[model samples]
Target: MDDPYKLHATAMPLEQRRAALTALAGKIRSGGTELGWQVTWNVDYGDFTWLIGGHINNIGDPFDDNEFSSETKAVERAVLDYFAELWGIPPPHDPQDRNSYWGFLLTMGASEGNIYGLWNARDYFLGKDLLLPEHSSGDGVEPREPVLLYSVESHYSVGKTAHVLLLETPADVGARRYPGQCPIEGEWPQGVPATGGGSGPGTIDVHALRALVEFFAARHHPVIVVLNAGTTFKGACDDIAAVNEILAECYSATTGPSWQTRPGNGGRPDRRSWYWIHVDGALGAAYLPFFAMAPERADLESGIPVPAFDFAVPGVCSMVVSAHKWIGSPWPGGVYLTRNRYRMRPPPFPEYVGSADTMLAGSRNGQTAVVMWDFLARNSYETQTTEAVTALRLARYTEAKLTALQHNSDHVPDLWVGRSPWSLSIRFRRPAQDIVDEFGLSGMRVQVQGADRAYVHLYIMRDTPRDRIDALIRRLAEPGAF
Candidate 1:
């Protein structure tokens, strides 16, 4: 009989695990694996070596700081400045915002970065302008609500901020667009209600976003539009420029008989009509410089490019990217960059600039800041192109395999490639819950999420291998694993 706890009974000692993993190295290759995500939970991090969990491949972890040195701080600033120069912008500001907070800072992940963008956006729209009545004093200004609008495809952090940040914020704000962030568990709701029965802007379509912006502007509300540069699971980007143009056009619309027009002939534009677009680029933003230089290959879904999202785009206000995922940077590591440094739409600062906080995560790893610079300095187009091509090959390969499985198994639905070149998802005929649990046991983890139960995602790379990937596919296709 099996032991009381099969896994514990079968646990491999550290030395044994090292040996087993050392032997498996030949079988594993980056971007070719079922083992890549597995390695995430396996590899542990200490010193410069990353050998977390059960996985024991010693990937170098450059995002560490062990000392307090002015020279190192200077190096980080210089490197960040260098990156900012690459963007054709002023040098990146220190997180301390010494000179200005108008640029970028390293983050723990794109999720935290998105939260940060929303927090700033909320202040810009509601708090800073005396939009809230309590802040408006002798000016006789009544506090008004700032509405946050985004496609459902936008990062969850937006919603988190809506409930988590704005709820604490003094301004009364609500989320519009498709999926409203109003509390589902509570009563009377809060903020703005969705216009189209909350079906959400369908499929990141720009037209839907345009219509929503117009509807809200008609109410004279301050608005901020968030665009998904790299949606979590699907990896698609919203057409940002088109969305901006739509909001701008609506802002200029002058109609509504003689009465509907405001005191200034209603032709006077609502400065608040100027909407912001913060790209939630968790998995994709770091490769933007690469995309900016080489648009042809980079624009492809399987290639790395900033094509549809970035600060380079005229209207994009802010963006975030995850270093922990593709870059192998340690946890709680993400970054945010913004073109607007001084424009605050929220409270506490009527004349707003960037936050004094270096990151939304305060007292953060100054060490990671140095290492992030190192990664960027060492990151080259050549390495990215190689990684992109490999990831694409595996994604395309898995697509074919999963598609064939669908034909044979009626339960397995259509398995499609993700929106990004570097990511892919597989949909099975069976329930995603079962699939999730099965993968857990095998240490071949994937996600069964993204607002759909039928389609499950199998992200490739980091440290996974082709053999494990094949094994996962085979097991999934078999009768029992489902």
Candidate 2:
């Protein structure tokens, strides 16, 4: 048979195309149980099939009405409002109100949101009047150069954003391309190092972070810190509240040249300090609130502690969450939420798009908003909280099962089964290649007791249940499976 995945200049027969698509769908369905990534496969988008064929683009800000009538801005706004309520922010009453929440749908997942947040932070620290560029000419006290700081466990997007924005780092200062770009005049890691000695496996040490911030603040440099609500590999969350406390202390102690103390453009207020706190909550942000709301629920009594990472925390300026991770979207998409006061006043409205281009992407995916709205509408708060608790329970079950298997004398030895508190992922000894491929497991190598050991993790998403975990255990029990 000809390869169904191959494409040619000549069009295939209609019957052949149908058969090829059917075969591909069958393969996906057959392997659905083995999907180990963060993506949730228990979603049904049958009701949205009709809207898929239309070219509905959400052009600009969700709250602002644009001339593009074919967009789904209303639905997008509803989605943002839902998240605002979840993340403890007041919904926007008016588009121009600075106190209300402001945000937009992202077409390119959390990476786009991360980039957007970092860009806003960089510009905000630079004191550039984005709304009126003409009035920003050498105004007020010269703003201190901003330095980028993030945990070593942060998503690769944070570092990539720093490189793209040309933001200074301790390691990149004396390099070949841009010399002396970093203002910090001492040794520092490119990324803030994570905590060691098993206090918090993948979380950043707040003390170390405070020391670093003090070092930078003393040198008259503004700071931008990216906190992770859920790390990629270990699924650990940083203590955002503690970090906020550190920022408050630093703010009180530091006496530096003020950046936004004088109104340069748009009559902005007198802000004494320059700092930005962004949370990359691609996984945890989507469900942690639900966990917090229903901590006493029967199934969620696993003793896993939930950390706060939302607008309620005073220092958090911006946050992003992936729809595909916990909310189960078909494609990579998300929502970026921040207060309207913190939003960078967008450049003059573009007449071509017929709306103010406040978001990162001009032509956003309208169908994504519909899909997210559908999911949220179909699932109530109670339903979502139950589902979140179920996922956590399954993760605990997997960890317990794997630990049992490790202790079994006839089965694998030195399994190194481990899981973090409130994490939906379990890490253990790497199984054979066939098992890894069949289960869609992700592998990593780390130093264990001073010896390098191979590890693989399984994420307990919405669709992953005990039966699937049992099947994985059965495969590992086979002779020489590891």
Candidate 3:
């Protein structure tokens, strides 16, 4: 019996709507029991929820002129300022000037950020030094094609981004070196491309990367490097400092017709930077800074012993971090930060919203910025530092617990655990299907040493307490309890 109230246009009764929402809320709350995923589900956005009621559209650039919609663009500015300060990016001296550090909240998670960052890099390199001018017959100028390099473990969005932007991806270039395998010089099916995938998770083989950079440099092509700060699978972090050093070497190296150069020779050593490094710190960028800034972690000297994959890295021209992942925002949101010099690659123009169209998205999520701002405002730096320390400690505890279980068990013979020193993702042997489903674990079958192995990943979030981890460990240790 189809009730007239259930038809379209005629809205459901207030009571029915309330009841439906209440039921959904309960189911969602129940799902929050197992905190094995990356996001913190228990986050209360608090007073910022009020902003959702209004039709707020943060169109155009936040840093540019705005006179139309009365959205909370100012809060967005504060959020960017906080991140800029944290990442060592200096803001423009003048408020109206768009020639320094520029950043904005993005709508489509870190994927959007990745696209924006790569787009910026592509435009920057192409527009900097003209290689060839366009023909008078209406053909566009052919700039030196920029090569893109990223680890195999980089977010799948990176590959998609390359496709969307019409850039040559690694797969397109045919650089397919599996982990622990190197490409044979003469045996390559086609000409060797840029960098090969790293042997470790979320890392780029610096040796291979150098080779790739050199290969492109020989042809005078610009290189763009994407270093993973925290990867999706095994949570491996590429050595940003090492990569920076390699790029610096390539940037300053001298090459001439005879491979010999003197002061008066035409080979001025390509004084312009030949490479750009963009840190994909989507998972770690939000919290790692807190760990690095904590008082207890100060004695550790650089906290994680890595110089960090933030703006602090000299070669890092841009970075993208997810606010939804570590910062506990309700919706999928992220921040993309780049040098002001690189941001204006797309010439500024008057947008319909009265501001310049500088951002990746046309009509951006206004509420996302408000939520992020509210979260950041509520959580102080010291509190965030404590939270970061706690997350790392929990990861260590999880790893130790799994190791202990492996030590005591005979069934799980080759229990391989993979995790970076400063990451929250703990990768280990996959358990029974039921247990995995109960805990909401992310499982995948991966190849290790030419053997297929089933692995499950657990992400330690802020709300994941010690007791929750203990419960999971107990179940895992139980005989025949897989």
lDDT of 1: 0.49
Can you write out model 1's per-residue Cα lDDT over 138-214, one digit (the tens) per residue?
22122245567765555557777778875321123332332343233222233222222222221365544554556
Positional deviation of 28 in candidate 2, in angstroms?
3.7
Q: Write the per-residue lDDT of candidate 3 for residues 225-297, one digit (tens) a residue.
A: 8888887776667888888887777645733211211121132221224567888888888887787777777
Error of model 1, residue 107, in angstroms: 4.9
Per-residue lDDT, model 1, residue 319, is 68
Q: What is the C-alpha lDDT of each candidate?
A: 0.49, 0.79, 0.70
What TM-score does candidate 2 get on C-alpha atoms? 0.90
Best by lDDT: 2
Q: Rank candidates, TM-score, best first.
A: 2, 3, 1
Q: What digit string (tens of lDDT, one per residue) describes model 2 on residues 1-482?
A: 75776878999888889998999889876655654588888778888887777789888777778777888998998999999988988775455665578788888999999999999888777665544232322344445678888998899999999999999865653253335543333454798878872323778878778877776666566788999888888888899999988876775577433444334345654453457799999999998888887858534644545788999998888999998888888788998988766666787888887788788878889888998999898899899889888888888888888888878857577787877767887888889999999889998887755777888888988778688899998888888897
Of the pair 1 and 3, which is ahead by TM-score? 3
Off by over 4 Å in 1: 1-72, 82-101, 104-107, 127-144, 167-203, 254-273, 288-306, 343-362, 408-452
Q: Which of the two, 1 or 3, has more lDDT?
A: 3
